[model samples]
Target: MTTCPLCGFEFDGTALSCHASCAFNERCAVICCPNCGYQMVDEQRSVVADRLRRWLARRNPPVREIGEVCALTELRPGQTGRVIEIDAENPVRSERLQVLGFVKDAEVYLLQTKPTYIVRVGFTEVSVEQSIGAGIKVLVG
Candidate 1:
């Protein structure tokens, strides 16, 4: 069985071999996951890559639940969460926030939520207004 890197779906490669009729089937080593349609190279075709993938997967399992996601402002004081999404109305503001350490997958710790929302992302502590804090979503699990 093979596991998808993106969605963690596992299945036998041959079960989804509907790509046999494609023009590039002979040269293409890609396999598409039935669950999420994520195309990835078939690891069996490369022994080195297969071994590395297995090793990495063992170190960090591909399968993991995203858990509950909510606005950063919803987190209670002293709570920590993984930043999942930033719903900034402006693209420039979203990019700015990312540069300021509010990027997705970054861990955010709620320090306070009174006059302003104080969050610690990595080693940087940022004081944000309620509107900005509400735009940042984090995984609460």
Candidate 2:
């Protein structure tokens, strides 16, 4: 079984076998989500990868604290919080942000608000426009 990275739709990996009719199917590494048409690289399964994922999940469980939910833009620079939701008007834009590490339950650090909104999601610092930052809601204690 494979889960769509964007929509969280779980389906048999063979569903992607529809590319059997395509000439480049054998060499193509891209996989598309049937539900939302999101494309991503088809990485092979690895036991080490699975173990690391489990370990990381155990290390950082979901945050359940009762906290204020507000837009990422509302956070003061230097404040840290967990993402609650992204309310972008365009679904594709929301999914793109999710792919860039602003997904629910992930920790985010508001680095700065001036110039462009600079935020740290995991180890990557993402530069988001003010308009887009306003759509990402986070839970701040």
Measured by lDDT, the strongest candidate is 1
What TM-score would you give candidate 1 relative to the actual structure?
0.52
Compared with the true structure, model 2 gives a TM-score of 0.52
Q: What is the C-alpha RMSD of each candidate to the true structure, in Å?
A: 15.2, 17.6
The regions of model 2 sitting more than 4 angstroms off are: 1-66
- Give lDDT tens digits, candidate 1, residues 1-141: 889889998889866664766786655567889999998877666566888988976654232234767788777787788998899999998998999899879999889887788989899999999899889989975
Consecutive 10-residue window with the lowest summed lDDT within model 2: 57-66
Extract clashing residue pairs from model 2.
none
lDDT of 2 by residue, 82-111 (tens): 998888999999889989999989999989
What's the TM-score of every candidate structure?
A: 0.52, 0.52
Error of 2 at 140 (Å): 0.5
